[model samples]
Target: MSRRPHQIAILGTGYVGLGTAALLAHLGHHVTGIDVDVCKIEQLQRAEIPIYEPGLEKLLLSNTSQLTWTTDFSAVQQADTIFICVGTPPSADGTPDLQFLQTAVASLAPYLGRKQQIIVNKSTVPIGTGDLVVRLLEDLAPEFDASVHYVVSNPEFLREGSALEDSLYPDRIVLGGLDTALDHMISVYAPLIEQSFTPPASAPRPERYTRPAVVRTTLQSAEMIKYAANAFLALKVSFANEIAGLCEHVGADIEEVTTGIGLDSRIGHRFLQAGLGWGGSCFGKDTQGLISAGREHAYAMPILQAAIDVNARQRQMVINKLLRHLRTMKGKRIGVLGMAFKPNTDDLRDAPAYTLIQRLAELGAVVTAHDPVAMARAEREWSHLKYSSAVNAAQVFQRADAVIIATEWDEYRQLDWEALVATMRRPLIIDSRNLLRHPLTAQVEQVGRELKGTIGAAL
Candidate 1:
């Protein structure tokens, strides 16, 4: 591990890039976050964060002197290490679109200085993308010597809401590069690897992680690790939902079933809660990418395909439950709570609520949705749905025939059930995330249950 600091330039200021920039700066490295979005760069310059991640604002504020926000690609020429953290969204065929990644590499070609630099890919891309990048660099910079640049795969595993904490104290750090590139990456992340950095007073240390492990492998293997990890997690959630469906038929509680199964050493409790299924920037795309990769090699991943199929069905299952209770969605006013993919973030990419809202609209149902931090994004992306700016939970339920809990935000868990019940036209509640705990007068239907019950009687 090199004790000396290095100049790091991170491309894109979305969740992964900004978190990495903040963490690198906090580790005493001079970091410059580069993005094409002027608004995002201006926001960071003003000490304002563009995304919702716990403790990120504090991390950015404390390390502002060490961080630089810029839109210029020339900054890459001065950086000792360049991190490509752009988004690789899914294409029409479900394969990851590498246009952003390719464009970033091409943009850096003209600015490649004489100094040696390492380009670390922090984006979750398909396997062999590192090789593709290397080839592209070779073709683009034919005039420059090959020794001036090295490509490495360093995928990010940071969760949206807890990104800062995860970046600071990750379960493990993985690096996929050649022998020449490994030393530099290790030097850049040495403080994190050795657990030598002092934790900020504002962000407490995670009790579970005393020291993080490092996994070194080939670039292709490291790329697969990112996809495999996310795909397995998606499988776990889908498995839970499958069991949840059986639990409903057998009149068993999914919570108790998951607890019992998760107690076994082979099975863990993480991602086992049965609800509306996973939605975010990672799981769906990665799973689809894995499947697409399998197909490219003439192999079929039936289990992974099933997991994806189950996840899609779970969304329709929520709509099915609503249909069963409401009899007809036509002319019914339904309230949807928590529009974001998951709690603690405003990201709405691939959210299950989108399917529910679209299906409800197609049925001629009057839909009104609300989220703590995602309303503006939802209103912008999904302007068709009616949005409420009401602060009270009861206000969201006002004049609604039924209310469906979409994302499990903590505030939704503490809602005054009785008050919300009074505001609704039909006093019906569909708990998609299984977040409700209190007894209520409204009729309630949740995951793993066929029969509807009043909140007081159900509890």
Candidate 2:
């Protein structure tokens, strides 16, 4: 295995791409991030990350000398390992769209130097995408030494908020490609292999037990593993929501029920916190892609499809809860506590809060929403609704007839519930995440207020 430092280029400097570039550079590799957005490149060049990731900026600033962000494709010519981290948006029929992946392959063709470079698909793509990308590269650069270009399916498993941690200490790193390239790719991750350095910056470092082994599987299996992991997590949330609904009817507290079930080692609670639903970039898209992949292979992935269907209903369930309270949303003023899907990041791509806010507006409710980072994105997506910071937006709740705890941000959890409720016209609080059910929920109920849980009716 060669120990030579590789020149790596990460295409698409979004969350996955930027995190990958930062972590790789921190491991002492030469990394250049490329994207068509020059303004983003300019921001990154100045050591400013365009997005809000917890520890990403620190790593980006620390590795600026080795990490470069640019709009030029010339960088592609010098890269020993180029990761295609561009988006593979879902098609109208819910299948994975390969247009961006294909476009990236075409763009890299003209710059195929004689050097053998591993062109890795770091993007979350469908199974057999490795073969498709490899074929596309060959057709596009037939005149060049096509044999030098190798395609690998190295899917990213980073979450939006904690991408850095997940990258550094990934539960497992699944590298998929031709058998010939496996050893070389393993050598590239030697720092992690030898335990010389830590995992990516996104995952939480273990406090006691030994680290989980990084599994190397076949490309198709590796691709399937990514989808399967996300699908299961989504399923867990949907399952929790389904149980929460059952708990409401049976007079069982979901918090206590989830805690009891979570105590079991196998079902060790992580995504079991029942909320409006799972809403992020991965779960929805990957589950659909997996179902599409199953159809392509003439297999039925009914279980995964049910998880997707359950998640969709979970979001609507929150709207229904809100409707049950006000009876008619017409002329109602609704205040949303959190707007981003999950707190800490400003990514509002598929946040459930948006769905609830939209539904409220459609039903003639005047909605005012607040989120720490996602306000700009939400403003763009839902132009009609009012966006305010948690501080100033206190007025929205002050005059609001009802308040919906949509995102369950830590900031929202720490809010002075008594004071905040004092501002509201009706002082009604809906704990969509059961976030306040503990000491806070008990405290609020003692204050003679009408509070509702995701599944339970208002008190």
lDDT of each residue in 1-459, candidate 2, tens digit only: 456677898889888888888878877789989998888899888877888888888778877788878888879888888889898888999998889888888887778788788888888888888888777877887545556667778888788787776777667778887765676677777665554665444444656535536677778888888888888898898888788777777777677778899999999989987767888788999999989988988999998888888788877776776666679889988888787778778887788887887788788888777787777666677676543445444655778888888876777666666666667777666767766733322223211112344522222
lDDT of 2: 0.76
Residue 132's lDDT within candidate 1 is 93
Which residue runs does candidate 1 get wrong by more than 4 Å? 142-144, 384-392, 449-459
Model 2 residue 4 CA deviation in Å: 3.0
Give the TM-score of each candidate: 0.96, 0.91
* Number of clashes recorded per candidate: 0, 13
lDDT of model 2, residue 10: 86
Clashing pairs in 1: none
